[model samples]
Target: MRFIIDVLLTGLAIFLAALILPDSAVSIAGFGWAILAGLIIGFVNATIGTVLRFFTFPLNLLTLGLISFIITVLMVQLTSYFMGSKFDVANFWWAAVFAIIVALIELLLNSIFGSKDRD
Candidate 1:
């Protein structure tokens, strides 16, 4: 299904991002851990992340969407937390960088293989 493909793509992106970053910035146990991390990240984002974004909508608008980026950074940290020893981020700034890298990779992957109907 499309959802499965998306998750795999995100997992690949996360693994690639971790490899691209310095060892002190981000670490992953393996591709399997990266995939599990991606699933947890997606779940967290779909649930708690959505609520946070909704409540912070006003602040996000005022900040010209910077708040959204911050929220995304926090989501990356939260994902690391949920992943425990398998996936780790050194600090807030590093997590932000990791998030950016993962997002860019995901963007590139999705553009190449995403459903054609998506607008």
Candidate 2:
């Protein structure tokens, strides 16, 4: 149940981000593609991202956690890699734009739905 909710939130965030970003940010078929890309992004973020954050802890701290934004952009790029035609990002800067939009959308959704206790 919680997993499904999380996926839905990710999907909505991706859909909204695609809409809010510039024409060159990312190209997608539509909502369906957004949902699929979101799933890929979430998967990459959950798995590889955890290990990456752990290894880059020093940089993360040194940058006042700013490395997170770069990691988020990487997540988008990874999603684009796996998705091929379904999704396309212009470049690193565009990926950053998409990441920012996705983060904002996720924040808004999480606020509306409220956070689930980890424990």
Best of the candidates, TM-score: 1
Model 2 vs. true fold: TM:
0.86
- Over 63-99, each residue of candidate 1 has an lDDT whose tens digit, in order, gives 9999888888888899998888899999999998898
Candidate 1 residue spans exceeding 4 A from truth: 116-119
lDDT digits (tens) for residues 1-119 of candidate 2? 88778778888888878777766767887877888898888789889888899999999999998887788789889889889877989899999878887888888998888785431
Candidates in order have lDDT scores of 0.89, 0.83
Which 10-residue window in model 2 sums to the lowest lDDT?
A: 110-119
Off by over 4 Å in 2: none
**Candidate 1 least-lDDT 10 residues:** 110-119
RMSD of each: 1.7, 2.0
- Error of model 2, residue 79, in angstroms: 0.9
Error of 1 at 15 (Å): 0.1
Candidate 1: the clashing residue pairs are none
